[model samples]
Target: MNTVATPSEVTKGKHQIDLIDGSFTASEAQDLVVPMLTKKINFHQIKRMSLFEKNHKDTCAPDRDRILELEEAKATVEDIFLQAKIEGKKVKMHSTIHITLED
Candidate 1:
């Protein structure tokens, strides 16, 4: 796990955090990313359910949209892993999380 960060480049009340950046084997990439995506999907699903239960009129549109987006990302990752396996090559992955104050 390699992390790259530049404190000087960050603005006040905002931060960019490097989560994962490295080359990994096919199985390793799957193990790292698939579960994360699944967890995100599950998180949105639960949030949607909670909102719906709290108010029957609530559509949970944002949560539904996010779940779809995450599912597509997971599928793309799976395809990349499959292709890497066929080619017998390692996969390069990079991810970052950004945080900022609302007000």
Candidate 2:
């Protein structure tokens, strides 16, 4: 396997992000936009990592009718990473991966 630079939050099952090799191609960067970030937050990061964004009660839709919006947002994030193949840029889990897991 290529030398992996996992992020602080990478774990075996807690979550996983299967991303494209952006370094291999730049056009693939467009694949990083998750649908939820665009439909809800109106912006999504171009990344290929299993990073989770806690949904703030305050930012939820004012309509208050879309209970699934959060999950959809998460799916969108997942889609962006998966389709883009943009795995975490650098190696992770080698440093303080659990230095603050309890915090």
Return the top candidate by lDDT.
Answer: 1
Writing each residue's lDDT as its tens digit, candidate 2 over 49-70 gives: 1123353333434333343565
- Tens digit of per-residue lDDT, candidate 1, span 1-46: 7565566544457777788899999999999999999999999999
Candidate 2: Cα lDDT at 33: 39
Question: Could you tell me the TM-score of candidate 2?
Answer: 0.22
* Candidate 1 residue runs with Cα over 4 Å from true position: 1-12
For each candidate, give its TM-score against the true structure: 0.83, 0.22
For residue 46, what is the lDDT in candidate 1?
Answer: 98
* lDDT of the candidates, in the order given: 0.93, 0.39
What lDDT does candidate 2 reach at residue 17?
A: 45
